[model samples]
Target: MTSTATSVIPSTSEWTPGDVEQAKEAREKLDIWPLDEYNCKLLNEVHPRNYVTNADEKEGSLVYDLIAIGAGAGGLVSSKQSARRGAKSAMITERLAGGDCLNVGCVPSKALIRSARAVSQVRRAAEFGVIVSGEVKVDFEAVMARLRRLRATIAPADGHPGTEEAGTHVYQGRGRLTGPNTVEVNGKTLKFKKCVLAMGGRPNIPSSIEGLMDAPFTTNENLFNLQVLPPRMVILGAGVVALEMAQSFALLGSQVTVVNRSSKLFESKQGDDEAAIILQNQLEKDGVTFLSSSTVQKVETINPGDGDKKLPLMKVTISDKVLECECLLVAAGRAANVENCGLEAANVDYELGKGVKVNDYAQSVSNPSVYAVGDCCAGVPRLTHMSGEMAKLVVQNSLANDQWKLSSLVVPAVAYTEPEYATVGIASEEQAKKQGVECDVYKASLEHNDRAILESSNIGFVKILVKKDTDEILGATIVAERAGEMINEVSLAMKNNLGLYAIGRNIHSYPTTGEAVMGCGVQYINKHLPRLD
Candidate 1:
C-alpha cells in the first residue's frame, strides 16, 4: 500500500507538473502495485526511477544494432545475446525488467508452492514413520515475505544493472514502434536495424463475467501481495495456475474450490486425460474441491468497513451454486500484451487474444526486420524456458543469419503441483491419434517403482507414446514427484531424434524414481524388440 516514489527515488529535482507525470509513468511502467520493501528493492534493481540510459542523452545518435521491446525473459535474453555478440543492442520495456516469470508467474509462485509443499510434507511426516510431536502451523505472512525476498534476491540478474552490464542499454518506458527501424520510449527515439517484440502476456480476466471487474479479485500479477491466507478461497479456471494455486492454498489451510468451464480439468491442452485425472485426483485428495462445467455468473465484494486494512469477502455466484470466500483468484487464461506498443506503426500483424504474427524463424511475417518471441508471439507455448529458447532463436537468426526454427524446438511444460504434471511434444495418445499418427503407449506406474513405494509417494505414472513398431518418441506425460525433472530426459530424446531404443540402452541407477521413465523405455523394448535367445 506504500508509494514507490518516496523509497525508490528521493525527488532531488523540482516537482514540476511534468516531472510529477513522469514519475507516475515510471511507476506504471514496472506496475509492481505493492510498494513494499521487497517490491521497492526489486524496482530499484529492475526499473529504478533515477536510472538514466544513453538513449536519454543521445537520442538521435543512438541507433542500436538490435532493439528488443519488453524486458521479460525473452527480451532480456534476446538483447543480451545480441549485445554479447558485439551488437549495439538496447532493450525497452513498459514494466519490470525480469518480466512475468521472474517477477510474478514462475519465481514467486514456485517459492509459494515450495512453502506449501513444506507444510504438506510436515503434516504427512507420520505416513513416512517420522512422527512429529507438535501441531503444524503456517505463517502466511512469512511465506509471502519469503517469496518477495527470494524474488528481490534474484532480480539483479535480470534488472537494468545486470542487463546494462551485459552490454545492452536498458530503458524503462512504454516502447512504441514508430517505424520498421525505429522505437520511441519516454520521448527517446531508438533507431535499430532489427526489432524484437518480446512484450509478454497478461492474465485474461474475462469481461463476460458480470461484476468481476468491480470485485477485488487477485490475479497472478498481484497475488503475492497478500498479507494473510484466506480462510476460504475460490479459484476460477482449472488451468495450470488455477490448479497449482488451489492445491497450494488448500495445503496451507484454505477451503479451496476450483471452478472450470470444461467438463473436465485440462481438457484444453496437454490432451492427456488420464494424466490429468491423476493430477486432479491428487489435488482433490489434498482438500481441493472441483466444480467442472461451471462459470462465474457474478462476483460481489463486501468491504465491511475495513477498507485496505482487510481483504474483502468475495461472493462468487457460479453455475448451480453460490460461494463466499475471503479470496477470489481469476486464472481463466492469458492474453498477449500486444496493445499500445504500436504494432501497426511497425507493420506487425497481431491479434488481441493471440499475439504478434511471426514466421517459423520468429521473424515478423509482414516486416522481416521485425521479430516476435515469448508469450507475445501467437500460438507459442507460454512457458519461461520456451520464451528463453525463442529469445535465443531470435538472436541467432537476426544476427548470425541462421534459420533455426521455432517449430523445430520441442517445448516442455510442468504444473508445479504436488505430483507435478509434466509434458512435452505430443501430450497424449489421443493427440497422436488425432494427428493420424500410428502410435503405441507405454506406461510405468509409480506404485510399482521401488523408490516411490519406499517413500510412500507412489500415486502416479510415467506414460510415453511412441510411433507404432518403432522407438520414435511421439510424446510423454509424467505425473509423479519430480516429474518435472524426469520429463527432461524424454525432451532431450525427442529433441535429438533419439528413440526409446536409446533410452532403453541408457543405464538408470537402481531403485530410483527416474527408473519409471527408463521403465517406459523397457516396456517398449520388451514389446517391440526381438530377443536373440
Candidate 2:
C-alpha cells in the first residue's frame, strides 16, 4: 500500500522524540486526533509504534487523499470510482459486512415479497384451471430461512466493502468527523484531503406518538426478519415504505390494516384518486382494512399466545378508537444521517430536510471539496439506483477527464405496492407554470388495454405530459403492474428530448401495458390539429 501525504503540509521526516512531539502538536493544532494528552497512550499502547512504523523505520501512516463514510450503494460506487480515477481513498461503515441493501433493505424485502407472491399465486392456482390442495398453508419460517440464505449468497457481489486496488481501504466502524478533513473511527483517526458522506439515513419514527419507543414495533429493517408471519398488522404511514410492506404482509396471509392520517393511501401520483379507491376496495375484499386519516396515538405490547419465539401483540389507540394487531410495522419515513458530522462547525450549508445541498454536480454547498448522496443526500429520488448515479457524478466531477453531469439523467421512483407506483419528469400542471412551458396532458386508462384485461391490472392508467406548442414530451406517470418497467420509456423520451409525434409514430407491442404509451401519444396527436394538415 502506497501512503502519500499532502505536499501543502510539512512532515517531521524522522521519528525522534522531538518528531513525535511535533506530530502530536500538529494533530492537536488540526484537531485531527492523537492529541497531545493521548499521544503517549496511543503511540505506546493503543496504536503501538511498531504498528505504524515502516520497514525502513519511518514512523508514518497511510494518509488517504479521499475518504468515503458508508459502504452502501452510494459509498461503494464513490470509492471504486475514486480509486479508479487515481485518488487514495477509504470506506468506513458500521454493519455486518454489507449495508442495508444486501443485509436488510432490498435483498431481504424483495426476496420475501417474491416469496409471498408465489404463495399468493399458488393459493389461486385453482382459478388457473388446477384444483388441488387440502387448504392452502404457508410455511413462513422456511421461506424466511431461504431468504436469509439467499441474502448471504449474494453479499459478496453487492455488499462486500472496498475494492481490490492498493490505495483504497475498507474498515468496519461508525465514522464521525473530528475535523473538517478528518474522521475518527472507533478511536482510530483517519485524515484525508477530501471527504464524502455516503452514510445514508435511518427510519424516522415520530417521538410524539407516546409509547411507540417503549413498544415492540417493527421498521422496514426488522419487518422482513420475522420468521412467523403475524396474524394482524397495523401499518401507520401512507408513504412508500408503509404501502409496500402493507401489501406484502397482507398477501403473505396477515390481516393488514393501513391507518394513514390522509383519506387516500397514495396522493402523490396524478389520477391516483380513482386508483386509490380501486386499490382500497380490492384489498378490502381480500381482508385488508383501511383506517384512513387516522393517527396512531400510542401502543402497548402484550404477550403472544403462540410461544416465546412469536412476537408480542401491539394494541394501538388511533384517535378515540382502540385497535389490536399481532404486530405493528412502523414505516413512517426516513431522516438524514447528518447529526454528528459537524456540519454546522464545518459551515456546510443544508436545507431543513433535503440534506447537504448540492447543485447539478453533487458537490456540497458548504465545501466544494466535499459531496453527499443517497437517502441522506437526496437527489431527484431517494432510491438506491438513483444514489448510485449521483455517486458516479461525484466521481466524475472529482477526477479524470470526464465532462458528464448526473442531473442531465432521468430518474424514476418505484413504490413496490401491489399495483406499483412509478413516475418520472415534471408534473403536467407544474411544468406548464414552472417553465411557462405550454403543455397538454394525455391520459390513457388501463381499463381499455388488453394486457390489463388479462392480468386484472385494469385499475391503473398511463398519463403523459407534452409541450402544448411543440409536442415535446415533458413527463409521464404509470400506476400499474410492471409500472417500474413502463416508466423507463417515458424517461427515455424526456432524456432524448423525444416528442409526442415520435412516440405516436413508434409502434408498441399489442396486449401490453406499454402500448398505453403509444395510446397517450396518439391521443395527444388527435387533440391538436397539425399546422401542415
Candidate 3:
C-alpha cells in the first residue's frame, strides 16, 4: 500500500513576525487563524505526511542495527543520535505527526496559559495604577482559536524537514515485540541488533467513581481540545497539572471547583509549610472553590445528549450532593502505555503500574538486547526533558560510544503554574531522617527578594537541604516565579559536585527569580561557619 498523506508548512518560514502580528489583528475581526485557506496550506506544509494510517502489511523482513519505538521526545532524540553514529535505524509511532508535547501536552497548555497570564495581569492591574473601564471580559472562543493556530504553526518543526529529515526511517504505526530483538509493525517483521522502547504514557482517570465512565470528563490529553470553555467545572486531583490547569481555566473564566483526595491543596510541606498555606488561602480568595479529603463515589451524566452541541450541560455527584457543572477535568494521574506492545511475547519485565524495568543505562531487564527510556522506563523522576537526556545515555551505550555518565546525572522537576515549584533531589525530611542522613534546611522567601517585590507577584520561597556535617547539597526546592528556569543552578550543583557555598559565590542578575537561588545559597553557606566558643 502507498502512503498518501497531507503535508504541513511551517508557519515561521511563511508567516513572518509581521504576519503573525497582522494575523492577531485579523483575528479580532475574523475570530479564527487569519484565513482558513492560508491556515490549511500552513498546516499541510509543516505536517507534510499525514500520520493517519497504520502500517500496512509488508511481507519483507527488514533487519536493522537499531530500532526505536515511539516518536516522542525520547524516541526522536535517540533515533537522531543513533543514525548520526552510523546505526541504520527506524522509528515508529501511532500518534499525530507532532507528539504529546506539541499537540496536547506542554506547548498547547503553555500557549493557553499565556492567555491566562494576560488575563491575570489585567485583574491585578489596579495595583499598577491602571484603571479599567468595564469588567475585563474573556473571549473564550478567540483565545482557543489563537492556541490552535499556534499549534498548527509550530507543529512543522517536529514533523517535517521537507523530506530526508536526517534521522531514522520513520514509521506510522504501533509496534509490538514479537520475539527477542525483534518487533512487528504493520504486519512486517523487523529484526534489530538492539531496540529501544520509548512508548511514553497516558493520563489516568480515577476508577472508584461508579458513574464517572458515563459522566463527561476530560484529562490533560483532551482538555485543551475542547471547542468551548465550560461555565462551571470540577477537577478531581490536586497534583501539579490539576493546580496549574485550575488556575489557567479559572483565569480564563471558568468557575473551578477542585476536589482533592489529600487534605492539603498541594500537600506542599516539603520545606516551608507556611508558604503552601499562603498560596492555598490566596487561591480561595481568587474565587476557586476547593474541597479536600473527598473521594468520588460515582460519576453520573445528567443527560445523554447534553453535549450534542459543543457546550454541554453536565452534572456530577460528589460529597453526596449533585455538583452541577458543564464539564469535568480529571488530572488524577498517569499510567504507562505498555499494553499490547508484545512485552509478554518477549518476556519483558514490567510492573502493571511502574512501567518497564530498567537500569542506569535505561536497559530493560527481561531482554539484554532491549532498552527503554522516557515515561515508558522507570526513573527517579519522569519529565519530558529528562527522558530526552536518558535516551542519549541509552543510545550512547547501545552504539558502544562514550559520552554521558549515567551515574552522574542530576535531574530537576518543575510545576508550571503562576507561582511555579521546582525541585531536585530529596525533599521529604521525614524520608531523609529515616534514611539516616543528617540534614539541615535553609530557606529564603520571595517576599524579601527585590525583583519579586518589584513585580508585585512575590508569592514563593526557596529552600536548600544539606548534610548536617558536610556542605554537600542533598536536595533543594524553589516555589517562585519561573521556578522551572531557576531550578537549574541547584541541578548543576548536584551534577558537578558543587556545594551551596560555591553557588552563593556565583553572582546572579538582579530583579529575577534566579536571585532567589543566590539568596538560598548564602543562607546555606552561612550555616556552615565555625561555631563560636
Candidate 4:
C-alpha cells in the first residue's frame, strides 16, 4: 500500500499554545489504523490494503465491481447489496460515512423532536384527565446532551467500522472522478467497473439577503449542537425544516418567529393548503409567530461593547418591520454537493443549482458506466427513503444482467412536525382535476378517531383520492400525530394496485389512528354505491 507523510503547518507568529494542542488532537484523530484481526474480519474475503494502494498497482485491472462515492444511506446500501451479490465493492466518503441522515439530518433532528414532544405532553397532561406538577420546566442542556448521546450510539452503524463489516473497503477522503472508471481518494486512485455517486447535499443559504453571511446564524449542520436555547430565534424560509424546528424550539422556551417570502407556508405542489393552515394555527397557538410574504432585507449585529460579556443580538429588517433575536436559522433549502467531484472531467452532464443528470435506471446520461443517486442526482425526490430505493435500483442494474428502473417505485414523503404531514403517489387533487381525470377524494378527521380522542391529540385528518368509477386508490395525504407511519399503508396499496374497496373491506383494529385510513376508504365506498330509492 502507498503511504504519504503528514505535513505540519508552519507555526504562525501569533500562534497560541491552545491552538497547537487542538491541531495535535485533530491529527491524532486522523491517523490510519493498522490492519489487525478486527480489520481482517471486517474486510472478510477482500484485503483492505488494496484500496489504499497507488493506482499503478491495479492499473488496467478492475479493483472493484462497484465503487460507491458517498457513504450515506444510498452509498452504504449500494455497497452492501453489491457485496452480498459477491461483487467486490468499496465505499469512499469525505465526511462521516453515515452522511447527513445519521449525523445531522434525520437522527439528530428526530431525537430533539422526541424530547420536545415529551415537553408538550407533560404541559398538556391535564387535558388527558391527569394532574400536573407545579410547573413543567425544560432542561435544555440535559435535552441537548441526551440528543448527542443518542446520536453517538447510532453513529457506529454508519461509521467506517460498520462499512468494513459490510464487506466494503472504506476510504476516508474526498473522492473525485479522475477517469471514467477510476476514482482518486486521498492519495490513492482506484479503478472500478461500475460507480455510483451518492454524495448527498447541504443546506442552501441564500445570498440575496445582505449581511446574512456576516451575521451569526445556524443551519441544520450546527443547530443540533446548541447547548442552551436562545431566548429569541428568527428563522428564514418557512420550509419543512424551519417549521419543525420553530415549533420545537418555541415549545422548548424560545420565542420563535418564521419569516418567508411566500404568503403560504408549505409548497403548493406536495402540500395541501388546508393542512398547512391547520399546522400554522397549531404552531401559532403554541406561541410561534409567522411573518408571511416577507423577506429579510438586511441583518445587523448589535454588540453591547464596553467589554460586555453578553451574547450579541441581531437586528433583522423584514419588509417594513424590524425583528430582533439572539439567534437566526436559515432553512431555505438544500443544494446538491456536485461541485469539486470532477463531474466535468468525467463528462457527467450536470447543471448548476440542479444536480447530476441521470436516466430511468439511475445511470448518468453522459456516461452509462457511472450512475448517480440521492440528492446529488437531478429530478429525483430528495428524501432519505427515496435515496435508499434509488440505491437498490442502482445495485440491481449494476450486478444483474436484467436491469430494474426507479420509474415504477411508489415513494412516500413525510415532514416530521407536531402533527406530521405525509403523502404518497400523486398528492395533488387539483392536478388530478387539471388532467381531466374524474377522481373522488375521501377524508376522515382525527377528531372522530378513538385513539386520537383518547390521547387528546385529535388535530388533523386523512384524505384519500381514488378513481371515481373503478375505486382504484390514486393518492393519499395523512395529517396527524403519526402521519409518517400511517401513510405507509396507502403507499403499499398503491404499489400493489389495491383499491378503496379492498381497504374498506379490510378490518382495522378499534381505537387507533390508522383506522382513519380505513374510515376514508369506507366513506368513499358509501358515496359511490348505488343510492337507495
Ranked by TM-score, top first: 1, 4, 3, 2
Q: Could you tell me the lDDT of residue 291 within candidate 3? A: 84
lDDT of each: 0.84, 0.68, 0.71, 0.78
Best by TM-score: 1
Residue-pair clashes per candidate: 0, 2, 15, 0
**Candidate 3, 1-533: lDDT as tens digits:** 11222232222323333355645633442223333443444334433323332212244425667788887778877776777776666777665444567667888788888898899889888999999778899888778778878877776666635322554566666789998878887776788888888888888767778878766677776676566778898888877778778888888888998888777754643433554565566567666788888866766676554332365556677776668777788887777878889998877888865789877667777787888887777654567787788878888888884545556778888777777777788754654775788887778888888988988878888888888866688887788878888888888888889988888889998767788888877876676668899
Q: In model 2, which runs have C-alpha deviations exceeding 4 angstroms?
A: 1-61, 96-98, 165-167, 268-271, 304-308, 351-354, 378-380, 401-407, 427-438, 528-533
Better of 2 and 3 by lDDT: 3
lDDT of 1 by residue, 416-525 (tens): 89899999888887788778888888899998899999987898999988888888998899998999999999999999999987898799998899999999888877
Q: Least lDDT summed over 10 consecutive residues: which range in candidate 2?
A: 46-55
Model 4, range 335-440, lDDT digits (tens) per residue?
8989999888788999776799998899999998899999999898888988889999999888784578878889988889989989887676775776777887
Q: What is the lDDT ranking, best to worst?
A: 1, 4, 3, 2
**Which lDDT value does model 1 have at 212?**
90
Candidate 1 off by > 4 Å: 1-36, 55-60, 304-308, 531-533
Runs with alpha carbons beyond 4 Å of true place in candidate 3: 1-61, 160-164, 266-272, 304-309, 401-407, 529-533
